[model samples]
Target: MSNKIKLTVLGLLITLNSLKAQQTSNKSYDVCIYGATSAGVVAAYTAAKYGKSVLLIEPGKHVGGMSSGGLGLTDIGNKYAISGIALDFYRRVGQHYGQFEQWIFEPHVAEDIFHTYLEKAKVPVLYQHRITAVKKQGNVITEILLESTGPRSVGRVKAKMFIDCSYEGDVMARAGVSYVVGREANTAYGETFNGVQLTNGHQLPDGIDPYKVKGDAKSGLLWGITKGQLAEKGSGDNKVQAYNFRICLSNDPKNRIPITKPAHYQPERYELLIRQMEKRTWKSLQDVFIWSRMPNQKTDINNRNGFSTDMIGMNWDYPDADYRKRQEIWSAHTDYTKGLLYFVGHDPRIPEHIRAEMNEWGYPKDEYMDNENWTHQLYVREARRMKGALVMTQHHCEGREMVQDGIGMAAYTMDSHNCERLVVNGMVKNEGNVEEGGFGPYPIAYRAITPKETEAANLLVPVCLSATHIAYGSIRMEPVFMVLGQSAALAAVKAIDGKSAVQEVDVAALQRQLKENPLADGSAPDVLIDNSDSFRVKVSGKWSVQKRGGYGPDYFLSDGHTDSSSFIRYYPDPNIKGRYEIYTYYAKLPERKAVTAVKVFDGKRLQEVVIKDEEVKVVGQTSGEWVKLGDYIFSGNGKPYVEITGNGEKVAADAVLLVAASK
Candidate 1:
């Protein structure tokens, strides 16, 4: 056996031993979490920091879910939406790459960072443990029975508070919490793009036929095509969005494996792809799959236009299915994805250039060694969303309605994968794809995570929070989930101390805790002043506010001139007298200034310095960055600010950061 295999066995043995030890003791915990995903890990770490014993259980062996799986090309709508532990996770990843902040990284690197959190917090994790049943007193979950495959791993865990962090919300469903499976009608929540959308995204061209033989009514429909008539545009249904693997592949010859035919491979399952490909003048695989680049020559390839990796209409049974049935669906997705990849590269009907280009990529040898170098986590985009206290609707995302008691913010687009592939007007087409963005970050209400007062009192659902189907699409992202998880942990601690239900916890106190103690350890937070802060910012002349490639919510672009008439200044308030290191954000724009100069004010003196652009640049995938100018001492009563000196060519003013010297 190889050394990697030995290490894999040794790790499993260690986890089994830990589970056995904890089960024999039959000890209760202060907080118990189901699903050790990215959100669950953060929740457990936060609870441990608050001096609570946390038991994190997972149905699988590994952690970090899709964050470590393959969705490394982060879906960050704006950097302004991330903060606290969620921001810290990305910063830690940035540190690994020797930069200020990194939005993308490797799989093993992400998983290792998650392990670091567990080790530092001393949180016990039980692998392969699924909730069999729940024992409750009144509305509170007293204990839960586990069905583990490992020896002596099946036991009950008693806890004061329980958090359901799984993507499917299994624990929340098993506890009899109210939830919904699929999309709701547009009229149900005043949403424009919620149910049964037949938009022009990831759709097939108009002439492709659905039958096995062209122009034959007797021939049956091709494989993977849904058998249903088109529904009304705004009608509701129980159908679910597609789910697939975010396959990680590499181009490095020394660290790659061939894309061989997988087990139970069926070539006919991808018949629609072949028919779709023959019609279009496809150049290469890039037109078929998005070739998003990651660090170390790896790619976070995902579904693209027309026919791709998404197994549409095959995941409808996943949200509410049992363990055995879910596993079957999971295996089917795995086989279908692998089959799609292999068939594209080997089938003769495909274009020669496409097959040649697809052959250059394979599984990364150094990642996911425990699962044959394939990601074990499937991208379940939207599942069973909880019907909690206050459901967030599209009005909230559109800024028409706002919530003051927000625990976190979400900034991604209202994105949904195609739900089904059908023949519309006798032509093969895909439906239920939605992608809408161009709004600012909206606050996620605190009540969204808590269940109804009558359903269950002590449970918090972070991953599957309460929201309308279309609204949930915008709020469901990994970073947003992590932020919600940390907030859930804080609320759990507050509920335990107050001896009250989750819904009854003080919202004002919880928000104070989040802002004052972001890391949950009383560490002082760095002062930040963005261009969006109109209260602390003074702008002059015709500076246009542009987003797309700017820092925070938006950045100010000079009116195509280097003059004082179009300049911006940021006033930083540290709230306490101290020596601080200040930095300015440099946005990536079309115009580049050769020598961009910035003026820093320190109570009594104003100093100008050219930005050290070479000293601070994002290593791999990010566009915007932070450049440190210098440190200054500030008086408690003085107003210190940074002004972008419009001396060079065109310039962009984004945001400023003030870090204490003590940090």
Candidate 2:
């Protein structure tokens, strides 16, 4: 049958099935989610768990956006920031590997986990439903119209609340919610790394010629170099960070598809890479790409260095482009990436050692089996950021500004890929490559995810929350997106119960629910006392707070080389006096820095325990784990405490967990 006729038949079949399934024709739900991404699925699951009817609509066939797409080597800066459903997701993935949590995983494993969530939520997903328009009535989203794939089934989905979990904030934009694309000027948000940045000297090592012909300006620039004048430092413009495919390649020959010359391949397109390789002798093909190892001998290939996988300056029009134009951009990116890979592995002019190493990797035959074994989701690093109630800025990221109503925490560095490659001082340079990271995990405000009270009060945007360009870069990790997704869903439920708009929902109630019923179930969350919880963790002597690789927000590092007085004490503060299972977190410690003395006070006596490095094990990508510190009783007074005393060796303090002896 013709494609159009097939769609027509499919639509008729759907209508007939709906009529049979129920007598009344109903197209309404309590919650309407417009993306089946990692965030989208989590949001739908959360809404359904709250006893609300949820309709999850995906623009494509896949469910778990980039998390299951291929960015399997998670970009998590700190595990302590992850909470509730997001933490549960990692634990579920970990169970597959016979562990507690797994960050680096195969693409198929992540997708299977998402499918389990959908099945548990009892939410029916409408696949290939592209947003055509959003209908709103007086600042409230009444319904959204979508055109499904195969056939033009443009239909309306009415909902009490809407959550835009899509990477591109199409629903938010269509609902008249304000949003902005591209980097903001430093002055706009008072950020240090907001605008046109050239901090990293010409991306290509000095003397890499930009012209088509060596040293001939009249010959014109080669591929990938955009023709433009470099913008002044910290100035704003309509430029977005480069996007690429976080390809998953496998080395197992039995399950690998050989790297072949893809259609529309152009060898000359990678002339810059050839020139870059020539400037500095590369040891292996691995050095050219940010190839992080995954389970089952697979790899998550990311853009790294100059002239790698990131198709620079190619996706600037994506955030505002229509569906067809976006597809064209996606196809161009795919062609460029495929052509680059084929050229690197097959080009005889390249080093034999590099080609040999690259030959060992190819598309995994077991993954994306439905789509020619290739992932369909593009690694859209950043796109449209909703200009919501509060715009997160550098001040918040650096811990200089704190959010009183935080819904989630983001700890990754303020990172951005090269926004646009440029010709600078006669050498090809990359701009907007900023990787500033030093501050600890900062809370993402609830206001950051909600639409402004003036526009679409019922809509919540979690993936594309309110933030400046630099702030979004830090907050734009898959795990963090999942965190915000759960929080957004809870806020939606609370708004429905209160008969209020999303912005007017009680922030305190939402925060309390996030803590008391973290997983959206009545089950209680463990009482946590992280080092970042300054009010609960008391410290003495000199303690250095280090970011990254900690259990919670950040960890404390200190040594008694000068004085043995340094100590970090945690107060569990169990609401009632009772026996609780205690555990202390251990971050990846420095060499010869493992031994530490821990003391727990049970209101009667002080019990001491010594920690050994080899005793604790690592799980997933996080370099930290929780070790039991024994159960103890608190007196209901402030007498009970857990302290890691700084001894002769280096001491590290992360977090303390108090679990009620009962489940």
Candidate 3:
């Protein structure tokens, strides 16, 4: 009886006892959160902390969705923008590491933190309960029916507020809320990056054949290759972005479990990858496998390059698939990933050096012990996004528009993994990988997370909120999900207290509670200047506003071109003059220049500070949060201006903030 197994059994026992008790009582809770994801956990905790009785239901045996499943290396765009319960989770994670806060951590550590949150908040969580049906009266949900495997076979939870925090938006869809699956045409939302991106994206190596027989059109296409005429760029389609498992691996022999071929493994499935390897000379395993280090010796392994981990074009049926069908898809992805590991380590065609290096790394024995040393959750990148009153489009991400009723911020790039694999002009290519960044942080509108009042007034959706496929790409990060989850719970609590619909809650009141700050004069801090603000653009190239998920919106993107010089200048108010801390918000992209030159004219001298692209610490109070450049004295005269010039590298002049150091 290992301690891990004992603890898991005890937790299950507690959950069963709680479920049995609840079923008998038939007590209606103030809030009911489904999914048990990082968002769900935080939402449950937030609701409980605010004096609302919360019921956290999870379909799986484990919690924390991807964060604790195997994604140990957190994908936080700008750590500063994360606040409230989400930030508290990270701070607690840091405490476990004996530091103030830490982003990258071990999977078990994250799970422990989630458990601690549940215990401290006294939130009762029922595990392995799938939502069978939702009972509703008009637009308000009355109760949710739950089905379980063991002792407690069936249960129902009545709650005033229901939050669909599942990654798949299962409850949202089952409840008859209007939602969408697959990509939308670029024209649908006046977006440039939405829809069927067949060209100018993540493509396979040149000269690869898509047919089983070379130069023969009659010969059927190879396995995993879709057969069809490529759709026009930006055209709408039913295709979805790829999904993969964030497998946790380890090189330490003490904890390593060798990768084995899956039971349903078919060598022909990965024929494209073998062909790719044949054409290119291998450098190292790192060229194909992306291994990011966790706190322990374990690694968060992910797909890299064109032919990597993402199972492209295989998840198109996942969004609308039933539970049984979804399980099949999950199994397929697991087999593909496990088989890839085994093939890379043992295949004869692979280079000796690459094979040897891959063979050294294997699954961690201590992690995900019950799931055969593999993550139980599949990384469902994009699924059923709700079509609510407000839709977060690329325009919102590009800073062309801003949501006034903001619940949280998202700063990650508008990233979408490959969606389809096809043959283009005699070459096999992977399509739909949009990695556009340069926009700063942008606010996720409260309306986006809420369903239309006519659809469902009592239900709040955080994980599968309203957004286009491209915008959802940026909003899909785990941290941002947690942030939105907290906000959604807050909104649910407010609605329950006010006896109002989720959409009818005062936006300003919610913002005040979220900000959690008040001045001596009983006024909230003037958080000024988001990406939606108008700015003066000057240069040969055009400056566009872009939105980073988790962070607010940013302005001034050069579109990855260095030859075209551009400058974005901002003038502060004439009456506001003092020693102020200047912060520049931009995407922390890998291709960003090491040093970006910015000139500040303080009505006396024009000073230049070389700002580092990697500095993402929140310095002072402002709406747009990012790295601080430095503090400088600004004359009361309206002439004080700051200018950002694009000189090589991908320049992102998103937003600038000047906070008065002294009033």
Considering every candidate listed, which one attains the maximal TM-score?
1
Q: By lDDT, who's the top model here?
A: 1
**Per-residue alpha-carbon lDDT of model 3 for 1-663, expressed as tens digits?**
664885577566557645753564378889989999999998988888888988888888777999998887777666555766786677688679774456777787888788878887878777777888889899989988888854455478888999999999988998999999888999998998888775445456788888888778788898888886678999888889999988788889988888877798887777787788767766987777677777667788777777888999999999998888998999999889888888888888888888898888888877777677788789998899999999999988877899899888887779898898887887888888898867766889999999999889999999999999999988888888998998888889899889999999998998878776311122223234544556533345555555433234334566655653567676666555568777666554435677778888777778887876455442211222345567777667647767777775567776566655642
Candidates in order have lDDT scores of 0.85, 0.85, 0.78
Which TM-score value belongs to model 3?
A: 0.80
Displacement of the residue 147 alpha carbon in candidate 1, Å: 0.6
Higher-ranked by lDDT: 1 or 2? 1
Q: On a 0 to 100 scale, what is the lDDT of residue 204 in model 2? A: 71
Off by over 4 Å in 3: 1-25, 199-201, 517-663
Clashing residue pairs, backbone N/CA/C < 3 A, model 2: 80-551, 80-552
Worst 10 residues of 3 by lDDT: 517-526
Write the residue-wise lDDT of candidate 2 on 365-410 in tens digits. 7787667778879989999999988999999999999999999999
Q: What's the lDDT for candidate 3? A: 0.78
Model 1 CA lDDT for position 365: 84
Q: What is the lDDT of residue 409 in candidate 2?
A: 96
